[model samples]
Target: MRVIDKFKMFSIGPLVPSAFSDGNDPKDKSFGCELFDKSEKNYHQWLDSRPEGSVVYVSFGSLAVLKKEQEIEILRGLLESERPFLWTRRKGEDEGKKKNLEYDDVIIDEKLGLIVPWCSQMEVLCHKSIGCFVTHCGWNSTMESLVSGVPIVGYPQFSDQTTNAKMLEEVWGIGVRAKEVEGIVKREELKRCLGILMENGEKGEEIKRNVKKWRILALGAVKIGGSSHDNLKKFIEGL
Candidate 1:
């Protein structure tokens, strides 16, 4: 198993370019070398139609398998928010559950939201339409949101996710963590967390400011002549 420290070093910090560091350029094509094309045409169409800084992108990463109640809470919260959203429910998830209870009906209603089995997450985050991210606080997902300059509503499930969410909300001030009650993040808590990040109040403005600061720093770390690029270059030379 990969040690978490080593993973963090290569994936974040100042030693390596983040996974989505160069994502702003859709025509770059360099990422295609390592990432597969998982996005659908309709997803792109939906993203294009959304106004800039308007849509809420939600995904809990690939490994999280939410309970039916948890899923319902999230869906209900999203619906209550009344914001345009794109949510990804990966394959084989929520299996054996009733069709009506699975939230599939809401996903099929395009006017409300859109859902897909899998998507190019980097591409989605890079899109101008994305304003906020509802995430699982996985390391890569956290880094992607940071570099993309999108604020977050963190719903961490386990392990390092809790730590990442703490940093996102408390340390970084770029997001808010949903408060769980009896091991469940209720719909009201979810909506409250979303509002704290998405609204244009004092706290929300501060979070956006921090997000912009981090985004510039993230991009600079990977650009030519930046700290990360120099470190990488020196390592290669020593080899």
Candidate 2:
């Protein structure tokens, strides 16, 4: 079994360049992640409490932990920047235990921030006023950010997030990752990355342009005769 694990079972080069490829692997079915239309709920009233052209959205991906210290540091950084923010604090039931830890609440003062246990992520991203994201770089979050055409401040926690960060910053020209990793994030680096992502700087302009191109490609991929649509047809036929 160990020796078998070391062998190459298939090729993946042809699949890399195409937005959709004819691959029979089970993973192929999930390639086109859907983006939903706006929700009916009136969460915008809450989100609009912050000023237009401001407000950052901060959230680690589902199942990721926000260490208590890391949470505090993130709060401090956001406060210091003086930008209005809508943050999502993890509140779901613990997977391994039913008990819950008390989350810090002192930082939610109205001068700068609003902290919700959980926010409607897709809806918030699609909102016109949201300026940037402080994200964990999960594929779902990454896809949402791309689809929304927003730049990100990547705070990759684990798994493929680090790789996704590389693509966003280096390859796709979309976002920047925080300098702080593990442990606690610092105020200065947080402010710096936020500035680059939100300001009228060259870096920000470049990312905005690139992300627009990506949005166009994403649409093309989903339309009829596009790679993603064709892949869907082939997938159903295989069944």
Candidate 3:
């Protein structure tokens, strides 16, 4: 069958994939491979210790290698926002001197944040401690954030990411895009975007409310008889 025909046989209807954090899946606790250790703080525990909806989670997906200057600005924005944060830096992202986010040299106070190599993105997004997500607006991350009811600060790097960011900011009303100066999203602009998402002001409240609305709709679509659920079911039957 052609690609479109094959997809026609599959289900990706108006429903979701039952993606959320209910604390039941063993995958949620999995730390991938040897990278996870008991000595490291659990996201759940750490989030619980802090005020609800007070933490910012940032990740730029796996493929993008940021320039050093941009990395520094991102770190500065997170710190200057004065909000506690959880940042996931993938292994080997900073391998070269030219292309990287040099997290090792940046210093964050103990009370300010925690940086990790990788994390369960879904679990973290659904956590009540997550106030907002700073993302490259990858498709999966974008959907997950919407379903998880977490607002976003979109720093789209390239490709489809830019389109997704546009939808998030203008169409969905769930996020604000950070404006870039030259080729970089400067610290001040990042700080301002984060403020728009994290503060209790009108813009932030509207975004939060929009996220919650979409979250409900997304979750509902995953349930039995839901549009997405039925589509998936039909696809499975065809298979």
Candidate 4:
């Protein structure tokens, strides 16, 4: 709600990229360094090989780190869910600060999962194979997942993330928040949340439907002649 003041305020935007847009591009906006682009495996091809809505995508973003125990729980949970997953653990982490935990060294069955240092996040989220995201609940990631119509398993670390998780789960009804004990989200709990999202259950289906609804709504708002597009045009005309 905008307050009535001397300066007018008009709501405009949620300009999601082409995955959820009627834009000309067949892809969402992508900008990344060539190093990540030239990774050994074609991550995009990997995504293409999987069944639609079958992959679990996990990333803690670049800055967040888990306790060694937490990392173990997360890894086990993903395996326990028995869903194919793609996980990214940013390379060159500060090992000292991370308490000597090395995520890259962990072995995963190639058939079950793949771990990479970096990839195009927006592109990954937009891919049809992504059924769910295990994320830190950062705002950008949250929006990308919603636009892609993928559900979430929020493992928020700090700041606005906690609140963002609440909105994603409680307000939007699009996902579930992992319960933690002594600052650690246990393996069983993580697996339980994953099941709630990926299993053929009432809650899972509801969340999927809600996220799909948001995707359509977001796409509708940004298309030509839509509310957001018209708002921008009107603003420009007034200038």
Candidate 3, residues 1-239: lDDT per residue as tens digits? 69978558554633223332231233342224433322234656767777888899998887777887887898888888898888876644233112223466765654677666667777788777899999999897898788778999999998999999999999999999989989999999988988888889998999988987877777677666666777777777877
Model 4: residues with Cα > 4 Å off, grouped in runs: 1-7, 18-20, 23-38, 91-106, 234-239
- Indicate which candidate wins on TM-score: 4
Better of 2 and 3 by TM-score: 3
- lDDT (0-100) at residue 75 of candidate 2? 76
Report the lDDT of model 2 for residue 67: 70
Q: Which runs in model 3 stand beyond 4 Å of their true positions?
A: 1-41, 91-106
Candidate 2 lDDT at 113 equals 62
Task: Provide the clashing-pair count of each candidate structure.
Answer: 0, 0, 1, 0
The positional error of residue 13 in candidate 2, measured at the CA in angstroms, is: 18
- Per-residue alpha-carbon lDDT of candidate 4 for residues 35-61, written as tens digits (9 for 90 to 100): 343335567887899999899999888
lDDT of 3: 0.75
- Which of the two candidates, 1 or 3, achieves a greater lDDT against the reference? 1
Residue 236, model 1: lDDT of: 66
List pairs with backbone clashes in candidate 2: none
Ranking by TM-score: 4, 1, 3, 2
Ranking by lDDT: 4, 1, 3, 2
Weakest 10 consecutive residues of candidate 2 by summed lDDT: 8-17
